[model samples]
Target: MKKLLCIVLCLALASSLLFACASPAATETTDAAATEATASEAAATEEPAATADEPVTITILRPGDEEKVKSFLEPAVQQFEAENPNITVEIMYESWAGWIQTYPTYFEADTQPDVIFWWDNKLYDSSAHDHLVNLSNYLSEDFFSQIPQGIWDLVDTGDMDGVYYVPNSVDTFVMYYNKDVFTAAGLDPNTPPTTWDELLTDVQTIYDVTGTPGIGIPAITGSEVLEEFVGLFLNQATDASVLDSSSMPLFNTADGLSALTMVQNLSKYAQTSPTEYGRGELRALLRDGQVGIIFDGPWAVPTFKAAYGDDLDNSPIGIATVPLAANGKKIDWAGTNGWIATRESTAAASAKLIEFLMSPEILLSHHIIYGSAPLYASEFDNAAFQYDYWKVFYDEAQNYKLYGMIGRNSATPAAYYTALEEVWQQLVLGQISAEDAQAAAAAAAEGVTARNN
Candidate 1:
């Protein structure tokens, strides 16, 4: 009996050991299955990354000389593509003249490039405002903070609530003169005009002595050239903007009359058929020594450099701050152009590309190649910006009371050109008095308020 009881005890101990070991194996198998199921569910829900089979192609426009633009842009595009294998970027090159004429048509067709190098003041001029993406939606606060607050304020026209443009070029006007012309006029080449009276005297002296046109006046209608040319003097005389924020004429005062009168006086010595020239033509005239003086932006630097070589300040081309008006504060007209993304579908990719372009190295390179003043404070240290002529521009940008274009903040940004084009042409042609021009400008402003507001 004792032997049989011992045998039963042994059998029970063996069964207990087997059940403990089997229980652990079953628990581990169940846990493994649960983990696999969870991973599979997560894979089903998560968004997929872009792949070779599903590539995204985006187009961006770089408006300039085709060969010059392609020289820098093509390599940059290749680098961007290599970094982002799934994205293919196409660059559309258009000359400045051609782009200006065709940009409106681009919006009409809904076939605008995904991203465009755009004019800041003209943001709301056409259907472009509707198509532009509010970059604030996609870019982070850190990204927006990269630019100065002043620049942000300048670009924020209050047309809409969000940022629509990323300014890459913040340009102000400067007086460009030909030293050869000045020397021939019996004037010191280094002593350019500093006041409206002095400018008038210099113009008369140059024309009298050298027989060259004292200046090239860009009075071409249907373009912003005439508007900018007159507006700069208006800014100098009034020390204020020509149009109020509401697009009302602010230049109908006595000071405004004087400014227009000065413009008319200066027109007498300008190249014949002043209406035939635009800013670009004026630059060419300056280059060829046909005109003694003209107001232009830093964009003329590269061309002048090519014509005059590396030392532009010492070359025949001379740059100075825009001449001031009597009793006028140091003021000048400023404008900006930047990148704008138009397509909502390509916003992400466009933003990525913009961020890449705005990187310090790339942006500096762009400023150098495009002959723009350094947009960032950090860029001032670059060797490319170290030229003497750049200081005049940089000073104007930093120290001057800069006003933007007329109607820049209004719904009808192009009102300045539309309303004043004919009268301005008449004023420049000496067919109308300055008082008449002022009255016509005021009426045009009124028309803009009525039509747009």
Candidate 2:
């Protein structure tokens, strides 16, 4: 009986030990499952897709008709949005009218633009001098390399002989002529006039046959229309950098006088007085075949296409280089507008956009659509663009010079150009000779220097 009781006790102890071990193992699995469930829930809830509830707006300022801009630019913006889901671009159209008034006020205030298109010369230099952001760090080296050479040079302030802005396009004069107008008038459409004398002769021939002036120039009130036309003449005769490098007025020279006189003497054959050739009127005249030739930018190409097509339905138009001087020299004035951040506001995001905009693909698009010369060698896609017009500009871009107030100081240039504007108007109107105009310009420039220094 004692041996039997001892055996039962020993069996019970072994069973008890086995049960304890199983209990611990079961609890561990439950804990692991609970922890894994919590982790899975967290992983599922971590990232949320973007919703319309959040939208960011960035602004850009550019030129040309708002309607025209929207038709072309909206698509490009949409393309950008596909890649940058977080960003939205809002475009604002700026005009030459009261531009100075509008731009400075917006820039100086705390509410600033994320990016904008700006004239890189005197305007940018002034912005830089005021301690606005410098975009040098943000713009990439590849982007810098993509800019056409002359276009990039225009943005350099020549302060430290360094660049402050990133140029995007080359804006300059090009010739627009009515194909139907010339054809109907028995003029050869195959040849475009290259020299000043030939241009006048063609106009004379057109008028003799059609009773309409062959060429039109705006001698009237606007600064841009008058100044650029005059600049072309100055450029053809001599180096335009004389004024910029020397900071002196050279308008009295034979070159300047000849440039001014070329248009002044053309008054008899012009369709309208200088003041009469405002943009609105010019567009109408060019389309109607009342005026045969005018100097314009790439911006006009699409407009001509829409209105005229390849036929004279609206009177077909053709593009050519701006007419050269009587000396047979071509001097086309080009303006390169670029993106600039004030020194204080230069940011990484801004540079990233600049980098994107400066890519070869973007530049090629810019060239084909905007008529800017290609900045990259690969962008030539010569087969696609299929126009010799690009070469005319590409060749000229290498030699052309940019003008404007671009020094360490902006106030002097602002004031000086304002004064020179008056002198320019007087010269264009034939109220003063080149000599007198130069003296007035000199006096005004000297006054600004003296006061500022």
Candidate 3:
């Protein structure tokens, strides 16, 4: 009986060992199956495409003014960044000294900024049309619904068939007079010049009475200087197409001579060696109260206000619509400074950045701080825009069919503007006759047209 019991115990021990080994294999198989199923479920579920840890960087080019950026642009960018934590904005501020030459180079190279601050009239035709993306197809309908029709109409001009640029602000050259200078000259500062004759006579009066230069004209070799002529005269002329259908000079006519003569007459009372000053330097002369009148854009309001403090609206300075044309007309050049993007850029990200910049809240804030006229019609009702000077600008923007140096619905060769500036410098310096300047400009334009063809 004892032997039988031992055999049974040994058999039970063997069975227990076998059960233990089999249990481990079964458990391992079940665990492996559960892990695989869990991983497959996770793979099928929708997850956030991007996380805060992995962010995209969007680069942009903007002319830098630290104070101005701090006052407005920087804050707007901060707001954008806060809203879009997954995206970053890298801003590079190129100086005007080399910007004109360097800006075009950016597109030629493989590394270009995702977005660029382009002058709607200046670079829109040349840089934007060729290199940038046509945004009309990508922009949402709600975006178009927010902007004014007239503002959008200006974008689709000449060979630019689609909306390739978005204008942040609209501006025109207006007459900013130093009221103190006017008062010192015993002239009524309240009554700004209405006619070209009045403008010249007032300038001469300021010179004769104040012993300071009556006006400071930007006569340098640039499109800004040419726009002075176009703003002051060409818009008033009967047919102001500076470039005809074929991009040839059309300004050498009788109206052209007359415009040159008007500028030449005013030059006599202008700061000596006016060509020595660029627009910003010339504006500085006005800011220091050395010049009585300055033909500048609304973009300069911040500087003017910064210089004169509380007296910006009266006593020291006043803003007026640009002097009227000889035929009792009021027309001038205007620009909608644009935010343009490149075709090679990450379109989704770049478009979002543009939409952020042009958003009504940010744009209106910029206008309020920088004094640029807003493109959005909703901005017209802001309390900040109720000032008389702003009213003058708004009236001109609404009434006059303003164009940039390269007229509305038209484009000009870069050489044409270059020639106009050279001719204007000579004309202002007493080195060339109005007729001669006109002739030289037309001839240079003809050469440019031929070369382009």
Candidate number achieving the greatest TM-score relative to the actual structure: 1
Cα lDDT of model 1 by residue, 24-67, tens digit: 89999999999999999999896553333357898999898898
- Model 3: per-residue Cα lDDT over 1-453, one tens digit each: 999999999999999999998998999999999999998898778432333345778787766565665666567778888988878888776655566677657766746687877776654345445677777766788987777565665454566577778877768778888887898999998898988889999999999998989988887665456445543576576446566656677677787778878877888899998778877887788777799998878877777767765336664778888887677766776767778877543556677778888888888887886678756667767776655667677777767766565533333445666766777788888899878877887897777777766
Please give the TM-score that candidate 1 achieves against the real structure.
0.80
Q: What is the TM-score of candidate 3? A: 0.77
Q: What lDDT does model 1 reach?
A: 0.84
TM-score for each model: 0.80, 0.71, 0.77
For model 3, give the 10-residue run with minimal summed lDDT.
Answer: 405-414
Q: How much is the lDDT of residue 204 in candidate 1?
A: 90
| Predicted candidate 2 versus true structure: per-residue lDDT over 239-293, tens digit per residue | 5642554455555577766766675555446674556575556767887788888
Instruction: Give the Cα lDDT of each candidate.
Output: 0.84, 0.62, 0.73
Best by lDDT: 1
Better of 1 and 3 by TM-score: 1
Off by over 4 Å in 2: 1-100, 123-128, 183-186, 310-315, 326-330, 343-346, 363-391, 398-409, 412-418, 424-453
* Models ranked on TM-score: 1, 3, 2
Which residue runs does candidate 3 get wrong by more than 4 Å?
1-57, 66-78, 81-93, 96-99, 122-128, 221-223, 368-371, 377-386, 407-414
